[model samples]
Target: MLQAREGTCNWKANAASGMAVHDDCKLRFLELKAKRTHRFIVFKIEEKQKQVVVEKVGEPTQNYDDFTASLPVDECRYAVYDFDFVTAENCQKSRIFFIAWSPDTSRVRSKMIYASSKDRFKRELDGIQVELQATDPTEMGLDVIKSRAN
Candidate 1:
């Protein structure tokens, strides 16, 4: 059996103005953050010292997916997101949230994510990614959160 790891995913401002986290990395994080309606933007792939860096642009994106998707491809695209971990209704539970907008063409199943909530679901880190694709938030009986007026 697999075990879960206790670690936090850091959200930083995007290094590049127009980038996206590749087509595959959009996970539940993006979904949850979008629900929060935080102000942020995505950027395309950024390479330095032969390594790839994905981060939040620190800029607010109008259409989450559209902004990132707008990243220059043929070059490479990545969705860099910014988020804060705060104590939600469940004090003991820390909520990692993100706000984003993606086109309908964008999919949550593209990349691997940390499937379940730390205490609520599976106990594996990698499992989260697998689970992300396994279920659809809107269709999985999740509450419908309406978008606020801009």
Candidate 2:
């Protein structure tokens, strides 16, 4: 439980119809439950160009569709994923917003994923394509962002 000092949880289970309800209050409650997933990146994609400076490490998107961030989540830290030169399945086709995190408790080793789907964003990853890697980023929290110890 991650909760605001003066907050509460309201999980409404959608029964009878086998569905889900995203009430405003319920959404707030979900936010309260958010864990400080370390070092996860969230990119805001724009149309018609390569604005990032990362080495081409994967394929590109087809049917290019640029998207903006609906909201900024504190857990999401943005890092550019430059796929300009990549011969991906959909290069220059679909705009990509990469998000990654460490799905581990110890932080000694972790799994990282870079996906285009918002559902796969660093803040909320459920089912999406991701590239996993091993690294320790426990020290990569807000403090690290604020500190210039490089």
Query: Please, what is the TM-score per model?
Result: 0.24, 0.19
Q: How would you encode candidate 1's per-residue C-alpha lDDT over 1-150 as one tens digit per residue?
A: 122222222221222122323332344335435553433333322332322233444334444344334443223222223322224353432223222222234434322111111122122112222111212234211122111100
Candidate 2, position 133, lDDT: 27
For 1-150, candidate 2 gives per-residue lDDT tens digits of 466422432221111122222232223222323431111223332213312112112222321112112212222223322212223354442112233433344223111111222232233322222232212344333233223211
Give the 10-residue window scoring lowest on summed lDDT in candidate 2: 62-71
Model 2 TM-score, all chains together: 0.19
Q: Pick out the ten consecutive residues of candidate 1 with the lowest summed lDDT.
A: 141-150
Candidate with maximal lDDT: 1
